[model samples]
Target: MSDIFNTSIIFKSSIFATPVYGPTTIGNMLWFFIILVLAVIIAKIVSLNLNRFLKDRVRKNDLNLITKAAYWLIFSIGFLTALPNLHVDLSGILVAGGIVGIIIGFAAQSVVANLISGIFLIFEQPLKIGDNVLIEDTLIIVEDIRIFSTIGKTFEGIYVRIPNEKIFTTTITNYVANTARRFEYAVEIRYQDDAARAIQIIEALIEDEPFCLKKPGPSVFVDELAADGVIIKTRIWAPSEVWWDIRTTMLWKIKCALEKDGMEIPFPQRTIWVNLDDGDSTPKKTIPERNHVAEVRIHTCKPSHPALEKSHPNSITAYNGPDESDKE
Candidate 1:
C-alpha cells in the first residue's frame, strides 16, 4: 500500500501541499476526481429536489432553466475549490473573470434585467402558463415562461413574445388566478314588461346553471328606468375556469328565456300629439330618434270649420312644419 501510495506519476513537479492533507502526491488527482464526483452527486440531488418543489409553483421551461443553472453553479464552486489540490493558481483567472464580468454586465444590461425579473416572477407567481391574462391591454393565454421572455397566444391566434422585464413591471390581470370570478350583464327589457318577473326569470336561470356559484348569490334587479326600457342589471359569480363560457352562453340563454316568457327588449319610441287646433300641424312632442327615419301620419285631424273653409277656399288650410323645439 505504501509503495503504491509513494509512487510518483509526474516527476520533478513542485510539491503542492495543504495543512490538513500533507504533501500532495499522485493520489491528489484521485481526491480531485472524488471531490468532483461528489459535487456532481450533490448538484444532481439538489436539482432534483428543486425541480420537484417547483413543479407546481413555476412554469416548466423556467424550472428547467433554473435547475440547469443551479447545477452548473454548484459544480463550478466545487471545481474551483478542487483546483487548488491540483496546484492550479486561481488569482489570475479570478482577476480576468472580474474584468470580463464587468464588460458583460455593461453590454448585457437588458439581459440581466430580464433574468432578474424572471427570477422575481418565478417566486412571485402573479400568473402561470395557461392563465388568461390582460397585460398592457392585450388579452392572451400564457403559453410558456422562459428566463428572458414569456410566450403568449392572443385571442386572435397571434403569438406574442413579451420580455420578462415588461411582464414584471406592467399590470397583469389574471382572469383565472382566483377560483371564482364575477360577471355582469346590463339587460334592457321593455318598459311595459314586468321588472319583477324579469328578475325572477333571470334568478331562476342562474340557479339552474351549474357554473354559477350560489354562495355569493346572483344579483338581479332593475338598475335603471330609461325612456326606452328598464335596465335589469344581472351579476353572477362562477368558477373562473368557465366564467367566459358562462358569460357568453348565459346571456343568450337569458334572452331566450325572457323572450319565451313574453318579455321583449324595447327600442326607443315616442307617441306625438299634434295640435290640430292650430293652422300649423306642429307636434306637441317630438318623435323618437332611430337609425331609420319613420314617416309620421296624423291619424286623427280635426275637421276644419265650415265658415273658415268657405272664407279661405284657395288658402293653405294646414301647414306641416318641422319641429320648432330645437330652434327655441
Candidate 2:
C-alpha cells in the first residue's frame, strides 16, 4: 500500500511535477473539488438573495425563473473553470453541441414558442394567480403560471393546463382586472303597462343593493318596442367582486316588484276573424202581391261561382246575361 501511494509517473513536457492520473495532478484534483463545493455554496447564496430581491417586485413564477437562472449561471462558470484546471479541451464539444442545438431547436419549435411566450406573460403581467379570466370560451381561475404552461382551476372545479403560446395568442378577458364592472339587463313589460313605472321600480331595486355603484349611477330607459311588450333596459355598475351577485339578485327583485304592482308581462298573441256566409251577392228583387199572395225567394252566391236565379211572376232582374254576339 505504501508503494502504491508513493508511486511516481512522468510524461514528457507535462506542467505538473507529480501526476495522479493522466495529465492531472493530485493538487489539481483537490482544487477542482474545492471549486465545485464553492460553486454550490455561492449558487445557494445568490439564489436566496435573488429570490428576496424579486419577491415583492415580480411574480412568483418570474422570481423562480431568475433564481434558477442565477444558480445555473454560477454553477456553469465554476464547471468551466474547473474543466480548464483539469486540462480538458472543449473546442470539439462546443462544435458538437452547436450542431445538436440546431437540431433540437427545429424539433422543439412549439416548446420554444411556449417558453418565450411564458416569459412575455411574466413581464406583461396581464393576469395573476387567483384571477378570474375568460379565454375564448373557457372561464377559469388562474392557479399557477409555469415556464411552458399555465395551470387554471375552472369554475367546475377541474384543473386545466394550457400551453403558454395559446394563452399569449388568444384574447383574454380578466374579470378582476378592473375595480368596477357594468351589467345590463332588458326587462320586458306589457305594451299597455306604464313604462315609467317599470323603470322606477328597476332603479329603486338597483339603488337598494349595497354593491351597486352610486357615483356613476344606474340607468333605465325604454330600449325597444318588441312584439309582446316594451323592453326596458337597465344598466348598472358594481364592484367587480360582487358584480355577479348584485346582477342576479337585483333582477329578481325588480321582477317581483313589477309583478306586485300589477304590471303585466305579455305573451305572444294573435287574432283572426271569419265570415259565416259567402260575401258575394247581387241586388235583390222585390215582388208586389196583386191577389193577396206574397212569396219570397232567397239565393246565395260565392265570389268564385254565381248561382242561377229562379223565375218569379213579378220579379225584376238586376244582372243581364251575356249577349250572344259578345260570346261569339
Candidate 3:
C-alpha cells in the first residue's frame, strides 16, 4: 500500500511537469479537457431545458434554431474560458475571428436580413401556421415558418417558399384572422318582379342559414334599378371559418327561392318605331330577347293623301334597329 501511494504521487508530479504544447503541461491539457466535457454536458442540459420551455411558444423551425444557437453559445464561452489554461494568446484569435465575422457579414447581407426579419416575424405573428393568407397577391395556407424562409401551399396545390424579409416587408391579408367576416352579392331580378319581395326572400334565406352571424345581421335592399333588371344587394356576416361555404350555398338558395316565387331575371329590351308615308303617325314597338335577331317587315297602310294614292299606293316604309348581342 505504501509503494502504490508513492507511485501515484510520482505519476502525478511527472504529468504536472510534462510539457504538451508551448508552456501548457499534461495537467493543464487534462484540466482543459475536463472543462470542455463539463461544458458540453451543461450546454446539452441547458439546451434541452430551453427546447422544452420554448416548444409550444415558437414554431418548430424557430425553436430548433434557438436551441442550437444557445447550445453553441454556451459551449463557445466554456471553450474560451478554458483556452487560457493552455497559456495561449487569445488576442490574435479574437482579431482573426473579428475579421472573419466582418467578411461573412458582408458576404451574407441578404441572409442576415432574412434572419432578422424572421426573428421579428416570430414576435409579430402576422400569420401563423394553417392561416389562410394572401401575401403579395399569392394566396396560400402557411405550413411552416423558419428562420430565413416560410413554406406554404397555394390554393391551387402548388408549394411556395417565401423569404422572411419579403414576408415581413409586404402586406399580408389574413382571411381568418377575425372571428367574423362579411360578403356581399348583387342579385338581379326582373324589373317587373317585386324588389321588396326579393329583399324579403334574401333576408329570410340569410336567417335560415346557421353559419350566418346574427349579431351583425344582414342587409338586403334594392341597390340599383339597372337596365336589364333590379339589382338587389345582399350583405351578410358569417363566421370566418364557414363564411365561404355559407356564401356559396346561400347564393344558390336565394336564386332557387326567387325563382320559385315566380321571380325571373330579365333581359335588356329596346323599342323601335318607323314613320309611315301615309298620314298615320302611330309608332311600332319591337321587344326582343337577348342574343336573338329581330325580323322587321313593313305592312301596307291605306294612304289618305289623294296625290300619293295615284302615285304609289303600295309604297311602304320600314325601320329596324341593328342586332344587339349582350355579353355577360
Candidate 4:
C-alpha cells in the first residue's frame, strides 16, 4: 500500500505538478481579437460607404429600410464572430432564434404585411411626392413615403399618417398625374336672348384668357334646357396648377363680357291660374274668375340709369357725378 502511494505521488509530482500556458494561448486570443477587430472595421467601413452612396438617391421611406438592413447585418456578423469569447453555442442560438423569429413573425403579421406593402409601394410608385391624390375619397397630398407608412397632408394643412398596408388596399385617384385638367361651367342665358350669339361670346371670352389651353379650343355645347332658360355648357382645359385660378377669374369675366354684349340674364317666372267654384253646372269656373283686370302699375327696375333718377322719391342717387363720367 505504501509503495503504491509513493509511486502515485512521484508520478503526480513529476509531471504537470504546476500548470504552464504555451505561447499559442495568447496567440490564439490575439488572432481572435485581430480577426474580430478587422471584421468590425470592415463592417463599419462598408456601412459608412453604403450610407454615403445612398444618401442622395434614397427617399425618406427607403431610409429606414436601408438603415435597418445594415444594422442587422453588422450586428449579426459581430455576434457570430464574438461567439467564441462568449462561449455561446451558435447551433443552439440559431435554432432558438429561428423559433423565436417565427413566433414574432406570426405575432406581427400585420407589421410584416405593412413592410411588404411598403416595399411594393416603393417599387410601384403610384403617386410621387407632392402628388395630389384622393385616397378612398379623402384628399391628400403625398408628403412622404415611409417604410411602413405614408405621410400625407390635407387641404386644411393637417398631417395624416396612413399605414402602407391600408394605403395599398384603398382606391387612389391622382389628380395631377396628367398635365392638363378640365374646367366646366353651366351658363344659362335668358329664354328671350339669342342662344347662338351667347355661345360665340363665351367662346371668344375664353380664348382671350392666356391660362386656358387653346389646343383644346374651349368647347361650348348646348346643355339641358333649364327651367328658366337655355343652359350652355362651357368646358376648358387648363394647366393643372392653374385650374382654380382660371375657373374663378374666367367665370366672372365671361359674365361681364356677355352682359356687355347685350346678353339678357334670365330670371325665374311663375304664372298663377285660379278656378272658382260657382253655382253654374258648366264646370263652375269663369274665364275672368272674378272679372277684374287689376293693373299692377309695373314699376320696372331700371337699375337707376345714368340719364336720370326720380327726384323727391327720396334722396339724390348715389353716383360719382357728371364730371366723373366725363373723365371716362
Better of 2 and 3 by lDDT: 3
Worst 10 residues of 4 by lDDT: 289-298
State which candidate, 1 or 3, has the greater lDDT.
Answer: 3
The lowest-lDDT stretch of 10 consecutive residues in candidate 1 is 293-302
Instruction: List per-prediction Cα lDDT, in the order shown.
Output: 0.80, 0.77, 0.81, 0.72
In TM-score terms, candidate 4 sits at: 0.57
Please list all clashing residue pairs in model 4, or write none if there are none: none
lDDT of 4 by residue, 1-328 (tens): 9998986566456342432343223333444566577767776777777788888888644554576568668766865776564445678988999999899889999998898988898889887777889988678988888878889999999998888998899888988778899989988887667889989888888778898998767889889788767899999999987787898998888888888988855655322322233443544322221212121111122235443344443222434334665467
Best by lDDT: 3
Q: Show where candidate 4 strays beyond 4 Å.
A: 1-100, 271-328
1-328: candidate 3 lDDT, tens digit per residue: 9998986676479757798877898878777887899899999999999999999998665677688888899899889889887887889888998998789889998998899999899888888887899999899999988889999999889999999999999999999888899999999997778999888888888888888889898999899988778999999999988898998899889999999999987654444454544677775544444334122212212223333345554443332222242121
Tell me the alpha-carbon RMSD of every candidate: 9.0, 15.2, 8.9, 15.5
Supply the TM-score for candidate 2: 0.61
| Quality of model 3 by C-alpha lDDT | 0.81
Off by over 4 Å in 1: 1-96, 279-328
Which scores higher on lDDT, 2 or 4?
2
> By TM-score, how accurate is candidate 3?
0.65
- How well is each residue in 271-291 modelled by candidate 1, as lDDT tens digits? 554455567666456453443
